[model samples]
Target: MKVSVVKIGGNIIDNVEALDTFIQQFAQLEGLKVLVHGGGKSASALMKQMGLEPQMINGRRITDAETLKVVTMMYGGLINKNIVAGLQAQHCNALGLTGADANIIEAHKRPVKEIDFGFVGDVDKVNIAPLKAFFEAGLVPVFCALTHDNQGQLLNTNADTIASQIAVGLSEAYEVSLKYCFEKTGVLMDINDESSLIAHIHQGNYSGLKADGVIADGMIPKLDNAFDAIGEGVAEVQIGKAENLLQKEFIGTSITA
Candidate 1:
């Protein structure tokens, strides 16, 4: 059985009708075992609605103690349940879970050094047993990136990091293909130019491309996670657009070992 981990970004979640369309397309994939990791567009919106200003540090949420609660509720509770419900409506048995469930993902609370972000976690380990049980049971494991430390204190982890961790974990447990679908078609040579999708990228060229300023902003972290997964034995990392998701031929940049 081939398992595939598909991470749908926050940008995609923001569009309601578009998301529904994607879900319909995703459900149609034949014999595909999938895992989904989503982020906080709705969560951030809810935080703002409640008069809490969301902060970001180096593209990650500055999850202070108070903000951590907001994030947990938003991502793990609202968004997680909503997506699961949507998938379930399509008759897809998608199970929503947090990283803390069955210690499926374990993290250590990263101490504040230069950054004063509270309760942010860096994933140190991921246990794929529970995930395997769900997948083997014919359920799509939809994980919301929230994890905990030894003390069982909940910590906020980066969504991309969570996606990469799941990809690695799934790869280790089964032979799987990993796909990172976002707003962009792929890593472009020119940030302003949409047509410049890099067809193929290698480990050595990744550095040079970033140095040359081809990889910028959000794409850098996504690419880093993709490369990290590839290094950890994931067969391939394809970054692409949401609408083109159904296509057999990947139009985005392919990161290969």
Candidate 2:
């Protein structure tokens, strides 16, 4: 089976109309599929509402215990369910899940280093059996950025990493396409110019692109995850705006080994 594991950015999730539009596009995505979402915006909003100031180190959220609780309510409960409901409204059967549900994924708390990223989880394993079962049963699984330690702890995880790892896991059983959907058209040479989209990328020029500062900051980690997925046997990986998800003609930065 050919499967698409599509991830939507937190910025889209923060916008009501953008999220609905993205969901509509996603529902129309062909073949067996999975959805992974980021909810940092929602989580941060809620944290502020509750009088907790959100903190970050190097663009990654400092997910302390309190932030974990907020994210659980937002990412796992509100955002995930709303997307599932929207998919259903579009006549697509969707199953919303966390890594804890049915043990779909297991993760360990990020070990404390110079900075303790409290309660943040780095994925340890992805159990594809349950996912394969969901696919065979003709269900699309929508995942939120939450995972368990197999010890009753729900940890905050990076949704992009979760999506990439899930794609890698599914590659063993399916021809997988891992997609990173966000605000940009594609990976661009100039951040300000949409026309400068780097339509195709591979290992050969990726390092050069990075060295030239075309790919820097958060994009670096995202592309790293993409390359990791490619190296681990995923057939295809692309990054582009969420709006172009279902286009008959492809438009994005296609990553290859």
CA RMSD, predictions in order: 2.3, 1.5
Give per-residue CA lDDT, model 1, range 1-257, as digits (tens): 66777778777777888788878767766555564656637767877888988888897678877688887887788888988898899988988888888888899888778987788788999888888788668888888878988686998887777878877887876766777787877888876788988988888798898898888887777677788888898888777886665566558878887
Top-TM-score candidate index: 2
How high is each candidate's TM-score? 0.89, 0.95
**Residue-wise lDDT of candidate 2 within 118-217, one digit each (tens)?**
9989899999999988888889999999999999999999888899999999999999988888888999999999989999889999999999999999
Locate the minimum summed-lDDT window of 10 residues in model 1.
Answer: 31-40
**Residue 64 C-alpha lDDT in model 2:** 82
* lDDT of all predictions: 0.79, 0.90
**lDDT, model 2, position 163:** 94
For model 2, what is the error of residue 49's alpha carbon versus the real structure, in angstroms, after optimal superposition? 2.2
